[model samples]
Target: MTDLDFYARAVVDGTVMGLGQDSLPEDWEDRLGVNYVDDVRKGLMRRDFGLVEVSFQRVRGIWRCFGVGIQVHRLDRGVEAVVPAPVRAEFGEFGSPVGFAGVDAAVARMGGRLESANDGGSTYHDQFLSASTNARVHVVAQVDDPGVGGTSVGDVWSIHLSWRKNQDS
Candidate 1:
């Protein structure tokens, strides 16, 4: 499958490069060879993999990845400049771009159900519950106007795939 397809499926399946694993290995970052930009001691660590960003939280003294945020459209030129050229090129090579429509379809196909949505003037947000993994899925879109009935319809700005919150975490 194409990398884009893998990512889209990850959103529906609630697993992005092992982000939603029940228990992440202590050397996950080392194994992935991805360096985190933030300090792990802060309890929250962020790793930017160009097209996607993964976050890990320390739970019970173990580092557990909680979420992944994928960037779809490059809206900010200034921010884009900061990303390495090779990293930026990965997006172009990742296959056809997918927006909310594509992701929504994938969600339906994967048996995920929409939980909530919000229209925030220029932006739209949606929350979903993945049937397979029981994870939380979030989609953000950049829209010219609010979608009818609070539906998120626009070029997908970002996708946040995360594990369901645990009570003791």
Candidate 2:
């Protein structure tokens, strides 16, 4: 395997280990598929609860990974409940009586500054950037009550975390 290939594998392996998986997924190789275009490399992996994507580009005469991202989907309800506490601790807690206030407070405590928030008709999206790692974590929630103009953390459908190398670090 090339260096980029190794890096991509490492990302998947690390994610699996970090998330406390017993072993690499049976279809790990298939999930951690790789594709190439020109000189860029894209790696994708899917987990029971989410997906992981990593991208690398040739820079300064060397292959450099640009970003790594984790996207949790809402294909199944109660998915958020299964998120490991240790992982949640990494980003701070969304808190009990989960709601927008808790999520906002969690981001602040995690050193993530609000970057943007938008309403997408049925869903509300909020993006936060962590000062420590320069990574971004976005939360998407179902609009429970438009009249209230707020989203409940319990209504959160998905959460995505992304790490980009030196874009702002």
Candidate 3:
């Protein structure tokens, strides 16, 4: 079985266009690797980027990722205004930021399937199971329309993935 962190990294990197922990905010790490245990012990901890908030949990050798959230910001020198349409289309015809359609495609590409789905107001949550392993990945995507610098940039989608430890690993 693959390690939870390993599988999770694969899923996260895969979904987020090859971004890794190194790409996460420096506040998310420590000498012990991701500092996930401390974050969880201290309650929901977050690593903030000007336009994003990331949370994760890895404790007792298990993995539990909270979700990555992106805030809509107006186009600026450093801020990029983007719609994940092309990215989502590459995965599948998932409509909107809160739709689990793209996630369905992501899981399929990883050789998995949607095991369950839950709707929670502005957020959509789903779980995927690996066919070749016992890993379970949970994903949460939020639909947000935040005004950045007084600009109304509509519906921005932010997503995060959490993975359970593989028993076999």
TM-score of each: 0.58, 0.36, 0.33
Expressed as tens digits, the lDDT of each residue in 38-81 for candidate 2 is 23323322333233443443444444344444433321323245
Q: Give the Cα lDDT of each candidate.
A: 0.53, 0.37, 0.37
The root-mean-square deviation over C-alpha atoms between each candidate and the true structure, in angstroms, is 6.2, 11.5, 10.5
* Reference-based lDDT, residue 31, model 2: 40
Candidate 2 residue pairs in clash (backbone atoms < 3 Å)? none
Give per-candidate clash totals. 0, 0, 1
Error of 2 at 6 (Å): 28
Clashing pairs in 3: 68-160
In lDDT terms, which candidate is top? 1
RMSD of 2: 11.5
Q: Is candidate 1 or candidate 3 better by TM-score?
A: 1
What tens digits encode model 1's per-residue C-alpha lDDT throughout 106-144?
A: 566666654544534333455555555544445554345
Better of 1 and 2 by TM-score: 1
lDDT of 3: 0.37
Q: Rank the candidates by TM-score, best first.
A: 1, 2, 3
| Candidate 3 vs. true structure, TM-score | 0.33
